[model samples]
Target: MILRVLLISLFLFFSLQSSAFSLEPVYSLQDCINIALKKNPEILASKATVNKSFFKIGEARSGYFPQIDLSLGYQRSYLENKIGEEYSKQYSAQMSLSQTLFDFGKTSKQVEIQQQFYKATEWQDRDTVLQTIYSVKESYYSMLKAKKQKETAQEVLKQAQRHLDLAKGFYEVGLKPKIEVTKAEVELSNAKLNLITAEKQLSQALLNLKVAMGAVDMPDFDIKDEDYAVRKLNENEAIQIAIERNPQLQAIKFNKQASISTKELVKKEYFPTFTGSASYGYLNEDFPLDKRWTVFFQMSLPLFSGWSTTYRLKQAESDIVYYSSKEDSLRQQITSQIKNLFVQLKEASQKIETLKIALKQAKENLDLAMGRYEVGIGSSIEVVDAIVLFEQTNTQYWQAIYDYNVTYAQIQKTVGWVE
Candidate 1:
């Protein structure tokens, strides 16, 4: 009975685990950002690059530590002569240790260079995170826009169906022409086709959002829609923030510092390097031991290396200049981007206001047209024209809203706002 109970318990546990794995999770915008940060392959790779920089530091610091080596060997030799063959056997053990006494600060400068490189890598990782956040915001907003568009299309289809029904009823009563019914049917067919297209667009948007989230499969869930308000911002202040806080710029700054350190390290090559070494050896012939020890200090100076040292120093100096120029270029680019996005955001906000008023007028026109047609005072074409105008205005209004939201996201990205 106990064995049977154990088997049932195991089966139940496995069944629950499987169900959990198969369940789809609904995600908010923040949830998507967090998941991408945790699962995106590129983000993980950038993190690993940061880790590699740490190991490089350890490698650089190894120059300050002592190095030791040991060796053991046995040899046998036989010589043939007229009297007889004489045999000789030898055994040896050797050990050596070397340490850098000084190199005019060469080792220390190398360590400093590696430290700067690590800093640069850390900033690069932060930049990766910022980029991921931007991508998630874009895809999330796009999905929301697609959903709104689909809803608009469905409403238009319903309006078309109502028009069709009214025309058919009038024709049955001998109050409308056959051509009106045919036109209504044509409009209904067109509305249905548009709705189908809208649905396909929504599906594609959902797939894009899932890809941005780094999800293995698309989940079935509703996204929470929230109204976005236009916020006031200062362009000059935004540009200042980007220059001071942008991770890409900061990474380039670190790279420049590393290059400077490398240049200093190359200059040290002009001075002599001092290294101390010691060795101990023991040798035996026929089991008799002869022991020896030796110690020495060596200094090395580059008499000439085909001007390689000079060329290396020049290369490091060029790197410093290159990074400095890149920094200048990036700052200019940030300024231009902020200015451009600010204008677009403002224009979109104004457009939304105009579309709101237009939408109101279009709805009123549709209502008037429908009332006239119901009273047999207006033609079906008037009602149909009003609907087309209303649908167009409605789509334009939603599109303006989408444009505003996307422009705001671009501004946030330019200013290096991670959230």
Candidate 2:
């Protein structure tokens, strides 16, 4: 009975674990970002890289530890000569340790270099996370825009159908021209075309969102669209945050520091190298072997390597300087982008409000124009103008919302989150 219970428990455990891995995220933006942070291929690779660096650190430090050896041997000799036959068995054990006496601090410096590289790998992980957040937010906003556009297309189609009905009523009574009916038919056709286009765009956006979430199959999902206007930010504060928290600039700065440390390490090559070793083994002169223990210290001098060390040092130094310059340039570029986006965010906020008002007014005008055209009091031209204006306003509103969301995500990504 216990064995049966254990088997059932195991089966349940495996089933639950499988469900956990088969991600079907009907996720919010926050959930998508969190999943991406955990599952992004680049971030996972960076984690592995950091782990490898840790192992390398241990490998480097192991050089400062001791080593031991043991041996056992047996020999038998048989000769049909003047000499006789002999047999012997021997056993030996030894432990030998060597610490870094001095390699001009080479061992310590190597460890330091590895430590810096690991740190940079940590920074690389952060950079990758920031990129992932940006991507998910962009896709999320894009999906929202696509949804709004589809709604707009449906509204336009409804308006076109109403015009068609009015055109038919007037034509049957002999008050509307035949061409007006034809024009209404054409307008309805165009609305259908737009609806089809909007749906296609929405499908593509949904696929992109799912890809961003790193999900194989996701249920129907909706993005948060309410209250999507950009929030106000003081330019000075935004710039300060970006400068303080930007991962790209910080990562390159770490890389430059690591390169400098490596350059210093290379310069140490001019110093002598010292190592110690010991071993225990059996040595035999006759059929029987004798045990012996041995210990020794090794010292090496780097007189010259045809300028190889010099060239290596020079290359390291150059890389340090080059990366430092690149770091500076990258900071400037980010600062410029932050400034531009600050203005853009502010402008987009104002534009959203403006377009909100415009949409309302256009909707009212379209209603009034439709009423007049149905009674033959309004011209076809006015109805057409109203349709265009209404569509334009909706387009502007949705575009502003998309822009606001993307910029908000940008601001957050620029400012590192509190750990």
Q: lDDT tens string, model 2, 194-219?
A: 99999999989988977877763757
- Over 4 Å off in model 1, which ranges? 1-25, 72-90, 285-291
Instruction: Name the lDDT of candidate 2.
Output: 0.80
Top lDDT: which candidate number? 1
Clashes of 2: 0
User: What is the TM-score of candidate 1?
Assistant: 0.87
lDDT of 1 by residue, 1-419 (tens): 99999999999999999998887665787888888998877799999999999899999999999999998989999999999999998999999999999998888898999999999999899888888788888888888888887887898888889888999999999999999999999999999998999899888888887777777574565576858788888989998998987888889999999999999999999999999999999989856669989999998988989999999999999999999999999989988988999899899999999989999999999889988888889888899899899889987888888888888877777677887
Q: At residue 355, give the lDDT of candidate 1.
A: 88
* TM-score, prediction 2: 0.84
Error of 1 at 272 (Å): 1.1
Cα lDDT, all candidates: 0.88, 0.80
